[model samples]
Target: MDLNWYWYIGLGVLGGGVVGWVINAAVQKARKSSAEVLINKMREEASKEAEHIQREAKVTAKSEILKLREECEHELKERRREQQNVEKRLSQREEALERKNDSLDGKLKNLERQEKEIELLRERLNNRENELQQSISKQIDELERVAQLDRETARQMLLEKLKNEVKNESGLLVRDLLEEAKQKAEKESRRILTYAIQRYASDCTYERTTATIPLPNDEMKGRIIGREGRNIRALEAATGVNILIDDTPEAVVISCFDPVRKEVARQLMERLIGDGRIHPTRIEELAKKIAKEVEDDVYSAGESAVLETGIQGVSPQVIKLLGRLKFRYSFSQNVLQHSLETAYFMGIIAAELGLDEQKAKRIGLFHDIGKAVDHEVEGSHAQIGADILRKHNEAKDVIQAVAAHHGEVEPVSLYDVLINACDTLSASRPGARSETTELYLKRLEQLESIAHDFAGVESCFALQAGREVRVVVTPEKISEGEAQMLAKDICQRIEKEMNYPGQIKVTIIRETRSVEYAK
Candidate 1:
């Protein structure tokens, strides 16, 4: 039994084992299948994940391409807009250039037309000038033919005829006018001068620079010529004069250039002869006394002139100068007397001419006052007189008359004219002044010579102390009218060539003689 049991158990055990193995194998196989299924599932899952990742990548790439295309389109549109703006500006500039060129072409055409018109005007003007010149030339030729003479010959003939006519008519007219003027002036001048001369009658006294003193006797000469001529020398030295004690009959001559000094010496000698004192000291004293007396005499003469002329305003110094004129001499006439005569004549003329007589008298008195000091002063007596008057406060009219009387200054008033006329009339009076025989003959010869210098003059003679010239002309050479003209021409020529005191008459003589002797 045990055995059987053991075997069965063993077999049971083996069977169990075998069954367990088989189940084990089946379980392994099931596990293997599960592992493989898991692996496959995992692979499949991985593959599916990879495919989804690939699709996502493709979608992202497509979106990026679309975005790039859109950006390129926007950039191209901006570039096209910029190109259009550039083309529009270029077209506008071309149109403006074309318009300017058209306007310039029209202006150039107008300027060319104006230039052509100016050229035409110039040509027309030139043609007109040529036509005018030809017309003027034809007119000149016609005039020359009608005159039947050349232009120069016709002009000379007309001038000659006109000259003759003008000379005759003008000569007649001038003669009539001169005759009328001479009639009026001569009547008035003669009346005035005649009345003036009749009013004033002045005495004529000739003044000499030397004096003759009559001595009581000739023996007084030896006393005058003290021992060795000391007395005569002292007298001359004291008096500035020469004392001549000659062998004449009771006479002594005192010589000096100054009339005043000569008078003083004469008086001194006379007094010395009377006093019988002949020394140098006594001679000097007497000279001084005589000089003082001469000075008193000069002042007294000046006072006398002032009183005579009735001019009350002259200074004492001027009066003294006037008194000095009493001893002065001019052309052999006493200056004081000449001045008095001039003053008297001036007064008379002034009365006739309705001028101031007193003023005229004053002018005449002072006119030659310069002659008193002329030896000491230089220059003309008229100018010196005027200066002295000015220093002494004389009137302007008086000074001017004095100065103009000599023509040293221009005369500005009627006083100057009247004074000059009076001076001339006074100086030119007959016997007022004398000339030598030689001068008178020479003047007459000069008059005849002047008349002989003219043409057609046959002979000439000076008559009436050369106051008239008679000219004889050839009758065949000079007509009556020409003779009259010749006389006038000779008169004018004489006036120009000669200087005379008065007017000279010219007489022209023409004659035709019909003389036949029966033989």
Candidate 2:
């Protein structure tokens, strides 16, 4: 039984092994079939994808080729249009050049024709000139033969006649022109001057410088002397002035070159006399006090002048110098008052003439500033005033006006001339100045002598206190025109020879008297 069972088990084991092997073989075959089917499907999908890619590439290449072709066509069109425009512009420029060439040719031909015509005309003129020259020669020969005089003699006679005629004509012309000019200028100037003077008027009052101080008695003079002239010396040293204690009877004369110093000394002497304390120390104290007061008065006067004139920017040094004029005098007229008067006159005249009124007033006020220091400086007052103004940085016009105010320098502008006129007006007004009888008579004589120096003057008289000179001329010797000329000549000589204030009027009187013997 064991054997049968073992044999059956072995057979059964072999059968199972064969069945397992067959199952393995079948499974391998089935897996191989599925894998083959999968590979075929993958191949089919890959081939479809490759065909789609090839179609897309062909379509994209076609579109890109069309775009490139379109762009090339556009660029070619643009190039063709630009070439057409260039050809059109070149043709237009060629036509313009041809037209210009034709015009230039025509102009050149016209110029050639004109040049030829001018040459022909020049030849004709030359022929005519030659014929005229021959005719003139014949006329000259005939004239010399007819007159029975040489050419030179006839020419000289004609020349003399022509010279006489020309002299008369020129004299008449000059006289007419001079009369017309004088009438116009005199009318305008007279109108302006009369208007200016009428606008501003001052009194005929004059101020005189007082240098002598009086005391109560002679004892006051001795007390002022004070112990071997200690007080006088101290007073002089303090005031920088000279004290003249002469036998003038209870009076002392204070002399100083500086007007301000002289004024201070005068005040100190008066104060010392009034105080009755005439000693060295007292004098020193009084001098300082009076000097300070006078200085203040100077500044006040100067400031008042500046304010009255309505001018600005005057330097302090200039104002101080101007104030010194308060104690200054010219021909017994107070200089400060004269300056103010002059300034007013200048302003009025300048306004009438349409000039700078303020500048004119400034020039007038500072015109005579040199007189304040004329004693201390070596020069004319006008020159010194100019120097002072220049040093103080005044305007060039103002300095020039001041310098030329007295005619010391040539006038550079209208202001300079106006200052002279205004200054003369202030000084030469009625009772503005005074002189001794001797000087008055001397001036009159000088005026008469100057008139007599001219020919045809029978008698000359200085009337109006030397302000005017009337000349009587012989009518037979001096004609009407001659009298006018004589008057001018006399005036010129007087102006050149003499120095006097204001202007002098010269009147030439031509009169003829017929003497009859009725008896």
User: For each candidate, what is the lDDT?
Assistant: 0.85, 0.89
Q: Write the per-residue lDDT of candidate 1 for residues 72-150, one digit (tens) a residue.
A: 9998898898888888888898889888889889889988998899899899989999999999888877888997777
Q: Which stretches of candidate 2 lie over 4 Å from their true place?
A: 1-176, 514-519
Highest-lDDT candidate: 2
What does the lDDT read for residue 73 in candidate 2?
100
lDDT of 1: 0.85
Per-residue lDDT of model 2, residues 359-390, tens digit only: 99999899899998999899999999999999
Collision pairs in model 2: none
Q: Assess the local accuracy of residue 322 in candidate 2 as a C-alpha lDDT between 0 and 100.
A: 89
Best by TM-score: 2
| Residue-pair clash count for candidate 1 | 0
TM-score of 2: 0.68
